[model samples]
Target: MRKLDNNEDGNFNKKISNSPANKRINLRENPYVARIRDETESMRAYINYETAKEQVRRIDDAKDLCDEIKKMSEDLNSNFYSNLEISNSFGDIHLEDIPDGLRGSVKYIADNTGWSYLSVLLFVLLSIAAATRGRYIAKINDEWLEAITLYVIVCAESGNMKSNLLKLVMRPHESFENRKQAQHAEKLSKSNNVDIVIAREIALKQSQKNHGKDLVICKEALKTLANNVRHDRNMINDYCPVEEASALPRVFTEDTSFPKLYATMQDNGGGSTFASAEGNTFLHLVLASRSPLDIFTKAHGYEKFITETKRDGTKILQQPFLNIGIVVNPDIARQLYSNDRLGLHGLSPRFAVCFGGKQDEIVEDNSSKSDYNSYSEKIENLLEDNFTQEPSRKLIEIQFSPEAKEQLLIILKETEKEQNRTPKGQTHYRAYLRKIRGLVARIATILHIWGHAKPDNHFVSKNDVLIAKKIVYSISLHAEYAFSANGLSAYYDAQKILDWIKRHRHSFFTSTQVAKGIEKMKNDNIFPALDALEKLNIIRQLITPSKPRLCVVHKNFITSA
Candidate 1:
């Protein structure tokens, strides 16, 4: 309590600080101890500063991580939406997608038969072409393109009313064939009278001739020969002078041998459709041969070629147009895709395919009962024009307008880019891209005829090309899907997965969970199917601490369910 000198108080403070209990109170009072404590205090301040700095750095790191995650989520959403836009389903083609001229037929057939609009559209196009092939050609720029012909394969399961669909669409064609065959029968009977006269005259002359003398020396025989020459003046082979009766007129054949197909083509004057509801039967007939794609490729291009047979010697084909339209099961289509020869020989590229998906129930509309009458009338008119026109007249050439040509050029450029982007493994699909230009032009030509009142005078408009591109885009996507290694099998598995998800009402699931949920499906099947759905933007994967392989179903898919 008494005041003291600095040295005395410092000694006292030191003594007090030396005692452990009083150090807290007296340490600051001793100058030496206070200096030592200040050094320790500075070190503690440095450690506190370092710890605070580390915490601030961690906070900044966490901010960066949050931003990275946000960017990734945005990127994923962008890609998912982009893919959805790029790869639209075949059933995505709506009424607006079809041209006004053909929309009625397409919708009618689709509604009645439960076929996809794309399927019915392709069939109608093929039917029109089959009815009028060789009557019209397209002049796209300098290229003299052949008539609109297609090798279309609609992949669907059985009991899809393919036969009824075919019968309805081909009614006009069948009617024309029937009428022609009737005419042919009447003509054949009259022609047989001439044949009988010739045969009787020849028999009489031969009976009159002596065995020892030359048969030609007889005056009566010479007279009969001259009479026979007069009767031989009948025309055949599209108006070539011949003695034989004319071959039965035909537009298409369902079941025929390869050699017989060519014979029919000859009879029809170089155009025919090898169409069938049972496509596997047609496939088996065509593919039975070692080199099946040869004639098909040649005919598709309307190329001239000569084929020799054992009895017929050399048969020359002038300009053959072969259109094949078939409805096959998805399994058969996969077999076609897997055929190395078909793909490599370019037949696969020539085909336009449509995979039939889930069909909606058929709802009968009384208003549309007579919708097919207009279609039939148009088809019959085309057929009449083809048959009534002079054989000597050349094909009516369909040209494109300037705007259409520009649109086509744009499409060609885009196709080139697509070709460049296509992987090497997809050789046939790349070839398919290469063939798109011709395909578009052919479709445009057909659309021009279907859309215009006077197709012979009018040119293919830019709108025609745009519609053609829309159709071709859908078709190309289908081709890409079919050509993929997974193909229709993956599509099937994807449907199964969707069904299972719907049954169990799964909002989030793993591959293992899906595999377990699906009956008779192997674990290997789950990944590809899930991947397909993911690509389609139906579901997406999530990573979390609790669930590593978690996938959330798309809100749209869930709501639709």
Candidate 2:
């Protein structure tokens, strides 16, 4: 009878292999077998359903079988199939025999549930254990082998699971056995760090092939696995691969020894090395450092120490580190260092050393005195030897109106009084005025080139001098001929005067025109004010046109004013 039953079983298996529904039913009897059968059937259905309609119902049946198979697989132990060579015999069934509909259903179930069963089971057991110690376990089979099977599944499917599994394990549970299993599972997940990494690599490859839609799913799986591992302290410290944990996406282990990592990063040449490993380059690792000082120090040290160039011609040292924070005080630096060495990881000794120095003293002491002396000598030589010819001076006539002339005299007297009131012993005061005059002369020449008259240069008002100084400083700061609208207007007026002289061949404005122009200018209050220009010898009155007479309309007058 036993031999007959065996023969019948063999025949039934053969018939099931040829029949889609029968095959799915047989697979649903064993969880592992059911999972594989569901996946295979679904994949086949998906491939064939595109061409056939009758296969859709079969696909739905296959999906039902897959779910049933997954539940059984989670519930069953290896002993349930100990007598059967399940792994070897399971592969012999022809998935093509399954109807397209059943195959599609199976594939969907497998794709979604195959990797997540263990995580779900663990989460349930953990939750139950938290509520009632023996009540949950006593109600179900507390088989060790069954639990281990679930553990293996958790590790294998870590890449596909959710981070919630981690939280579940970390939560307090009543059963010590359940807690131990959770802890073990968590550790295994972390230790299997390479699984998610491989998943990510596969995802990236898929993305490169224009399969970006699959990237999010793959990335989520990888993140889930990493989070599960990070939730348990024991798992984090023991089973988690320090290097691989560091490599995992979103795995932030602050306790990592960055200095040690940096030292490991250093090449034989004393420079930082960006050696390639497991899809990440040394440059990638260095760039991942969160400590600014660690980043800076590593970057600077890498540049100082590393010698190899990447395929793209970028040196390892060239990679920038992220999460940089400025060290304001050494006290802060010391505190950061004491609390966490990684916090101080990227700072350079030079930066920390110079943080306390006086800005002015540092600048003065660092400047080369010999270089300054050489520069001064070059300037004196240029002034004396090269500039031997006097600058051509055009005489400008100035016959200010009675009111304008009176205003000029009053301004001049005020300036002279201020000069006299300045401390007599202060040579710097005199030097400052001379500097101002020189700046005004140069500014006027520039204005003439741009076709404008010099604006008011009177220093009688401190505010006026400050405005002028700002203009000069602005030009110097930019190292270019930058001027405001007012400065441009002044330049245009000076150029007009130059143009007038060139066009007239030494003619000057008549006294009435001069008076009218001055009166109009006074009303506008454009700078350098007329009085200031005359005082600086930028424009003066000519005594004569032929003999250079001191007449308001004379060429000398025009040139000097």
lDDT of 1 by residue, 1-561 (tens): 788999998898888768977767765698999789889999999999999999999999879756654554344443343222212365458888898878877777777777778888888988878876666788886754655678888887766777877787888888888888898888777655765656655654554443324556578878876665444433122233223576788877764566787777777766677778878766776566464566788878767767887986776677777788888876677778767788888988899898763376675764554667888988888877775312132567788899999998898999999999989888988989998988888888888888776787898999888888889888888998887756555766777788888787776677768766778776556666667777777777654454435577765555567
Which prediction has the highest TM-score against the true structure?
A: 1
The local lDDT score (0 to 100) that residue 503 gets in candidate 2 is 55
Q: Please give the lDDT score for candidate 1.
A: 0.74
TM for every model, in the order presented, reads: 0.67, 0.16
lDDT of 2 by residue, 254-364 (tens): 223444333333211121111110112222333343533344443321223233325424233332111111212222322222232332232211121111111111122
What root-mean-square deviation over C-alphas does model 1 reach?
A: 15.6
